[model samples]
Target: MIYRSFLRPILFRLSPEAAHELALDSLSFFLGAAPIRKAVAARHRGWPLGPIKRFGLEFANPIGLAAGFDKNGTAAESLAALGFGFIEVGTVTSEPQSGNEKPRLFRLASDHALINRLGFNNRGAAQLAENVRRRPPDCVLGVNIGKSHRVAIADAIPDYLTSFTAVYDVADYIAINISSPNTPNLRELQRREPLAELLRALQERNDELAKDKSLRQKKPLLVKIAPDLSEADLEAIIEVALNANVAGIIATNTTVSRDNLHASPAEVQACGEGGLSGAPLRSRSNEVISLIHRLTEGGLPIVGVGGVFTAVNAWDKICAGASLVQLYTGFIYEGPNVAKKINQGVADILRREGFKSLDDAIGCSAK
Candidate 1:
């Protein structure tokens, strides 16, 4: 009520990226105190949805802040105070980057969507690891890693491994991002042979790190794929993920397709080429999640994301087979209370449907 009616309008006046930075900065400054975060989390508390364990990490709720929101781990603890079960920060690379250019993020207000060609802009894995170590969030933290923009396709494995090893200790789980259409030739790594080889090398490194640290098990490794994949592409990725023994799949990143949007082609085209996210991405993302669930036969955990704004949207993804649900654009459009709202609504929906637990609700709609 407050966000859409009051705050959103003021924030909307600023450029999307500017508004985001302001909001994050405000949260970082204001909620930096532990006492304040406790109060905020208390105020935002919803139905007792309880903790959810997936990929060996336990989430306070199923809703998480998807990667790309906090490209660096700054403000994570403050954001965690708002009630996210977990937060996935970065598409960080081994090397730091400034990303595409000015006006790279555009809003399609009518569609409640955003198009971004930010190109994995961040302070690099080492810096993010340091920030996270200094002021880690209260909830689970998943660090998302990608190939460096300067790195070539042939060298992707080593490039990714650089980031993989950098954030290994700080991250609760690691998400390997081979999707995002923003980076040039990055998606080529998603091809079967390359994808398999990459995951294999990373897992081997994961094993070594666990042993070195005297940890009982290697940290969870998850793959974040794209929505535009064909069935064949999805199958090959899934097969590779399972064979590599990854912890889970993020189901989607963002889409290059501009189809089926309420925004006119002229309006969308004006934003130029980039990955489209938010409401326009919901259907395809859900389809991908359902397909991954079916392909894995409930064996591999899936994180469903894209276009999730409310409880109903979250419930839809939960039904479609997401063990965990995440949102990026939805958080942008909805405001600070989005996570609490979705969490509350999901609990209500679960009760109305008489499900034993969230696990029972998983894949209920997939066929």
Candidate 2:
């Protein structure tokens, strides 16, 4: 309430990207001291409600900070203190890149949405690994890897492999991000043959690395797909994922579609070509989640990640098929208490709906 009524209004006055940077910097500074960090954790870390075991790792809760928010792994520890079950950092590449020119992130305030073409701007994968090694997040940490903008389509596999290897040691799981519209030709990698080859190569290396490290468990590999894909495309991608033995799918990244938004055409067009996320993305993301759940018979774990704002929205996704949920724009709009509020609300909804546990509620709607 304080954040929405007071802080958000002040922060909203700044440009979206600027506000984001300032917020991250402030949080990082405050969390820099170990005492302050622990104190924040104690205050914000909500009680363990219903824990979830997915992809061989146990999540303290189901709400997570999505990849784009902590692209470089810079503030995972700080973010973890705010009650997220997991924090996925990076759409990191093998090499460092500056990403697109300024004014790339836009806010659709009236619609509760954000459109970003920030392009995988981050310090390289190696740098992120070093950051995580120095101070890991208290909860599960997922590293999202993407193809370097400079890397050609044909060499994408090796490019991604380089990034995967760099973060493998620190990441609890690795998310292959081939869906962001900002990167030229990145979505092309989501096609049938390309997607299969990519997952196959990564899983094979995943096995080798785990064996070499003498670890009994290999890091879970997940693919984040765009919401723009067609139904047939989703099916093919699911087949590829199953064939490659991938751990799970993060259904629906930001959408290229601008449909059903209250923002006018001119205002939206002024934002230029970037993925639209937040409330406008909710229905489509849930549709995709339901489709994946129905098609897979709830066998594959789905980390739902588009347009989730409140617990109702998160619960809708959970009932539709997502085993877990992640937030990006919602965290931006709803303030730091988003996860705690959502987790508490979800627990209430589960009981109200007569569900015994979070696992039992998964895909109930789809069924």
Candidate 3:
């Protein structure tokens, strides 16, 4: 009620990227202040329903702040206080590199969407690993890794491996991102042969790291895939993921397609070429999730995302078969309380439907 009525208007006044920075800055400031963080966390006590254990880690709630929202792990501890079950930080690379040019992020208010060609800009893996180690979040922390902008398709394995090892000590789970549209030839890593090799290498290292730390449990490795894949592509990817014994898959990152939009042609054109997210991405993203769910026969754990903005929207993804849910653009449009609202609203639906637990609700609609 407060966000749409008050906050959105003020945020909408600035450039999308600037507004995003401002929001993060505000959160960081509040989060940095102990009293503020405590007050916010106290006000938004996560569903006392209890922890959700998946991917070998227990989450306080199913709502997570998706990667791209916190690329540096700088605010993980503070953001954790706001009520996320987990925070996936970074699409961090081996070496630091400036992302695409400015004006890369655009807002399509009419569509409640965003188009960003951010290109994995961040402070690099080593820095993030240090940040994660120094101040880990209260909730689960998933580190999202990606290929460096300058790394070639052939050498992408080593590039990602460096990042994986650096953050392995600090991450509860790791998300391998090969789906961002902004990175050149990065999606090629999603091909069966390349993806298989990449996951094989990373998972192998994950095992070694577990032993090195004298820890019984190694961090779960998940793949973040693009939504534009064909059905055949999804099937092949599923086979490879299962063979690699990965923990889960983040069903989508963003889409390059611009078909069927409520925004004017001029407005859409102005946003230019980038991955489209938020309400406009709902149908296609859900279609991808359904395809994966059916092909895998609910075997694979999925974190459904893209275009989720309402409790009904979140519930739809949960019923469609997402073991968990995440949000990026929705957080932008809906404001800070978005996670709590979705969690509360979904809990209400689960009770009304007589679903005892979230796991029972998975694929209920698709079934």
Candidate 4:
């Protein structure tokens, strides 16, 4: 309430990207100390209906800060203190990237949306690993990896492998991102053969690393997909993931489609060539989650992202079949307290709806 009523308007005065950086920088700077993190967490703590166990890891709550917020893994502790059950950082590549031209991020205030073609800008995987190791979050941390902008589609496997190995140890789980619309030819990797090959290669490496490092088990591996996929495309992906023995799937990244927008064509056209995220992404994201859940028969865990601004929105995703939900544009619009409110609300909803646990609510609406 405070942020939207006052701080957001002030932050809104800046360019979208500038506001993002300023907010992130301010939070990290103020909460950088260990004692500060502990104090903040205590103050803003949210009650979860029950601990959520997914992909061989236990999440303190089911609400997580989605990837791209902390692209370099630099502010995990500060972000966690704001009440995210988990934090996913990066869409990191094998090498560092400056990303596309400035003004890459834009706001559609009327529609409560954002359009971004930032192209996975980050300080690269090695740096993210170093930051994570230096200041690990108090909650589960997942690292999302993508193809370096300069890496060709043909050499993507090696590129991803490099990043995969770099953050493998630091991340509690790893999310393979092949869905960002900003990068050229990146979505091509989502095709059946390419997707299968990539997952197989990474899984093989996962095994080798576990044995090589003499760890008890390999890390959980997940894939993030775009919300714009066709049902056939999703079915193909499910087959590939199951065949490759991947751990989970993150449904519905940002969308290229501009359907159901309140923004004028002129206003939207002015912000050309970027993925649209926020309220417009809700239905499609839930649709994908439902289909995947039904197709997989609840065998695979899913991390849902898209249009999650309120507990009702999060609950809709949960009912549709998401095992966990994430926030991005919602975090921007709803402010820092978004996670705490959503978490408590979900817990309340669970008790009201007669669910014994969060797991009972999963896929309940998938008829």
Could you give me the TM-score of model 4 versus the true structure?
0.99
Which stretches of candidate 4 lie above 4 Å from their native place? none
lDDT of 1 by residue, 181-251 (tens): 99998888789999999999999999999999999889999999999889999999999989999999997
Question: How much lDDT does candidate 1 score?
Answer: 0.92
Candidate 3 displacement at residue 25 in angstroms: 1.3
Between candidates 1 and 2, the one scoring higher on lDDT is: 2
Q: What is the C-alpha lDDT of each candidate?
A: 0.92, 0.93, 0.89, 0.93
Q: After superposition, how far is residue 315 of candidate 1 from its true place, in Å?
A: 0.9
Model 4, CA-based lDDT: 0.93
Q: After the best TM-score superposition of candidate 2, give how far the Cα of residue 261 lies from its true spot, in angstroms.
A: 1.0
lDDT of 4 by residue, 49-86 (tens): 56778878989899999989999998987999999999
lDDT of 2 by residue, 124-160 (tens): 9999999989989999999999999998999999999
Candidate 3 structure quality by residue, lDDT tens digits, 1-367? 7888998899899998899888888888868877778888877765657789897789999988899998989888888887888899998999888899998999888888899999998999999989877777889999999999888889999999999998888888899999999999888888999999999999899889899889988788899999999888888899999999999999889999998889889998887888999998898888888888888899989999988988899888988889899999988988888888888888888899999999999988888
Backbone clash total, candidate 4? 0
* lDDT for residue 169 in candidate 4, whole number 0-100: 92
lDDT of 2 at 47: 38
What TM-score do all the candidates reach, one by one?
0.98, 0.98, 0.98, 0.99
lDDT of 3 at 104: 94
